[model samples]
Target: MLDSETKATETPEDHADELRLWLRLLTCTTLIEGEVRGRLRERFDVTLPRFDLMAQLDKAPDGMTLSDVSKRMMVSNGNVTGLVERLVESGHLDRRTSETDRRVQVIRLTKLGRAEFRRMASEHETWIADLFADLTPKDVRELMRLLAKTKASAQKSAARRRP
Candidate 1:
């Protein structure tokens, strides 16, 4: 009795389970991310993007090029530039032209920035631990195993879709 459009819009019973699982995963991710964002803003007065940038720099003691940071953060150079400007202005980061390549700008966290990041990271770990407190060790391990498989499957699908 349904029209073509109506039938197309409807999910058959076979696909319902996959759709529900996807929704549940998305919901959990959103909830956790929201809580982390709020906690970071309230406790550190810092945004997630800035925290992520600093975390990347923390791993690279020597510093990283603007392009490299942009790639690692999976954002545009402009975004990284703005964050770099603010952090430099706040004395939390140091930026300089690469001696070998004048056109390249390398950035690294300053002593102040490193200290602040370490402090924030320590607290952030605790917050994450608290968030997963309900999960038992076995549950955590199982989730990790399943998520790894999921990630591989997703990556394969993405590669197939790419030109």
Candidate 2:
């Protein structure tokens, strides 16, 4: 009774559950990410990339090379260099030459940076919790399990795609 073009434009109800599930996941992730980005900008005057860089340093107290940071963050070296320079000027991070490799530069968060990052991280967690407040504990657990499976599958697919 319906033309092909009209059928294609129909709602997810007309399609497979997988299509609906993927759309829901994408929408939820986008909504949450946008909220977090806005909050960070409004409250901290910081960008997501800077926050993520600080988070990486938080995990490694000693410090990591500029190259290491680039690899871990999956960003370009130039990008990491710029962030490191800005944070250093702001007194939130410190950069030093590696003792063993003079050519290598290591970066680490300063005391101020660590404290600030902790505050940001705490608030970020609260925001996420609030966003999912409607979900029951059981629902949360099940969602996490399913997401883990999905992530593993995606990772395998990515690996296969790599040369």
Candidate 2 all-Cα RMSD: 6.0
Each prediction's RMSD to truth: 4.8, 6.0
> How close to the true structure is residue 37 of candidate 1, measured as C-alpha lDDT?
91
Quality of model 1 by C-alpha lDDT: 0.93
Model 1 clash number: 0
lDDT of 1 at 163: 42
Give the whole-model CA lDDT for all candidates, comma-separated.
0.93, 0.92
Please list the residue runs of candidate 1 whose C-alpha ends up more than 4 Å from where it truly belongs after superposition: 1-13
Q: Which candidate leads the pack in TM-score? A: 1
**TM-score of every candidate relative to the true structure:** 0.84, 0.79
- lDDT tens string, model 2, 1-163? 5877777777334546878898999999999988989999999989988899999999999999999999999999999989999899999999999999899999899999999999999999999899999999999999999999998988898999994
Report the C-alpha lDDT of model 1 over 53-137, residue by residue, as the tens digit: 9999999999999999999998998989899999999999999999999999999999999999999999999999999999999
